[model samples]
Target: MENLERMEGQCLCGKVTVTAGRRDAVEACHCGMCRQWGGGPYLAVHCDSDVQFVGLENITVYNSSDWAERGFCSECGTHLFYKLKGAEEYAIPAGLFQSGSDFSMTSQIFIDRKPGYYSFANITPEMTEGEVFARYTP
Candidate 1:
């Protein structure tokens, strides 16, 4: 069960603000698109349906590719979320939060396609390209 706690966050310029409830599990993503967009491993906190937004006027949405759309602060260029096309929800960036939560990454996605420069020895839930594609396919 998800705790009924409010999580507050804003972009670097404070131009965009997000208020969401406690999420289930935060996870790290190692896909190529994530690395290019985030400049590092993408840490994502998944919420089922308890997300709210403020200062949305400052947010910029870009279709990074055909499959995913990236959200960021237009004024500050702070990456916020990635929404998969045809998926029902968005994946919020874990780093944009204020950071006092006890959440820890419980799994990793797109592990097999991860960059060769990095590695994780600990075993956790992971997905290969085929698995991810099939799960998200409409």
Candidate 2:
């Protein structure tokens, strides 16, 4: 297991805040749903379930799929996390956290679903949509 570091961040309007264990590597999700939700690929860090939220009343969670949900700050419209249902896992947007300058882009998922108009310069590992399902889904 890797050592986890504590990190903190707040929503754009400061109405919501998060304190969580930080993962060093950043990942991009290029699936259509992710792009549609964010207007681009989602750059995130895996924070697992070691997260605490302040101002719960200001947060809104949307069930994006049967197995997963997306969260945002209702007051500021800041995207919060993509979480797996009934699991201790979360993909929190990297940009939301402070001191994320050291986070490295290490992987990209849903490569097959990525649009041709955009691409990343990093030569990180890539996973297709099917591969992601096979590897992550039980």
Candidate 3:
């Protein structure tokens, strides 16, 4: 795993906070479920298992899939993280961290499902839905 730097961020309402170790590479998920959840691709950074969340009561979790769950701030409806079940791994929204302005768009996943209405200007590496499943699924 790449060495990660400590990062911190808070929800829009300031009701919840998150601290984690993150890399500078940001990835975009263009899967249908992700688009439906955020009304667009989810731009996030993969976080280490050392993620910490404050204000537990202000957070809500949804079982988005059998192997993963999504978290958000209940008070402000701010999306927090997409976490894999039975693991400490998390994909945190890149926009949440103000310090992440230097992050670079490195790659995109589920390219096959991306809508034609929009496109990213960066010519980053991409993975198709099948490619993503094959690489990530156990």
Candidate 4:
């Protein structure tokens, strides 16, 4: 559809530029790799399917697993987005987006696998691996 929110961002060296559309939902992930890659929890925003990706070919994708892929800038090492095979959508890290955008976090995935050091004060829905597999598995 039409662009919902005009958001722009770049990698550390400004080599990778991304423009997302209609991103309003965010999710904070405390998974081990997410923490290691970002030095903290990863904040992802669910952008519209029509997002205009520029310089995306420059971004290298890592197949985190058979079902998931993580995108990052090869030069600056800026983690960008995560995509799950057959999941019908992509997840862009909220921190990678331009600041001052209007967005709110919705859900926290892999809650049971989240690191133990951090505790969430807000009452958000949590999902375990079994729950995710149960819901997504055919």
Candidate 5:
């Protein structure tokens, strides 16, 4: 994580700023809830607990699931992050970052739920919905 450089980002309106000090490879989530939330699979970067938010007044968090919540800019409605309710981990949209972040698509979750209309060329690991839940079970 020390090698992963810090990155800076902001929403479309510049009312919300995201700064992350640690992050792992990017990931794509193909769950129906993700599609419904963003009109497509969520291409996200895993920042774990290292993301910092500036201008939080413009950020609104919605509890999308029992254990998860999603964040967006209240002023511009730019999708921010999907976070675990019990932890500080965050999955923020990869596009939101303005800096050239050092991340690669290394995994895709809910592979079985991915629609047939499109596909990613990355030869990354894939996990089905059940596999995802099993790994994250509490």
Candidate 6:
């Protein structure tokens, strides 16, 4: 079960505000697209449908795939969230949130896509790209 607590966050320039309910744990995605987008594994907080946004004008959404889109703060080019095309599955950068929540790294997706140049010390559960696509397909 997920906690019902609300977590608030904003972009670097304070142009975009995000609010989401408590997530179980933060996770990382190391797919090529994710790494290319953020320069490293994308540390994201999965907020299924409990997410809200303020300062809509400051946000820009890019359809990164046929079934997903990536959002960013136009003012500061801050990566805000990645969302499924027709659903409310939102994965936002964990760093955007204020420090206080008890966040833990519980898993990593696109494990095979992860480069061998670096690795996390945490012994988290990992999934390959095929597994992720099967689970997240619309």
Q: Against the hidden reference, what TM-scores do the models get?
A: 0.89, 0.95, 0.95, 0.83, 0.93, 0.94
Please write out the lDDT profile of model 4 over residues 1-138, one tens digit for every residue.
334557887777888887776566678776777777778787887765655567876799899878888889988888878888767477788877767366666678778778677876767777776787798677
Q: 13-88, model 1: which lDDT tens digit per residue?
A: 9878887877657788888888887777788887555577688899889988888898899999988788877765
List CA RMSD, all candidates.
1.8, 1.2, 1.4, 2.6, 1.5, 1.4
The local distance difference test score of each candidate is: 0.79, 0.91, 0.93, 0.76, 0.89, 0.91
Using lDDT as the measure, the top candidate is: 3
Model 3, span 20-98: residue lDDT tens: 8767889999999999999999999888788899999999999999989999999999999998899888999999999
* Pick by TM-score: 1 or 2, better one: 2
The Cα error of candidate 2 at residue 72, in Å, is: 0.6
lDDT of 2 by residue, 3-89 (tens): 566899888999999988866889999999999999999999888677999999999999999999999999889999999999888
Cα lDDT over the full model 4:
0.76
| Clash count in backbone of candidate 5 | 0
**On lDDT, who's better, 3 or 4?**
3
Looking at model 6, report the run of 10 residues with the lowest lDDT sum. 95-104
Instruction: List model 5 lDDT by residue over 28-73, tens digit each.
Output: 9999999999999999988858788999999999999898999999
Off by over 4 Å in 6: none
lDDT of 6: 0.91
- List runs of model 1 lying over 4 Å from the truth: 86-88
- TM-score order of candidates, top first: 2, 3, 6, 5, 1, 4
Candidate 2 Cα misplacement greater than 4 A, ranges = 1-3
Which pairs clash (backbone N, Cα, C closer than 3 Å) in model 3?
A: none
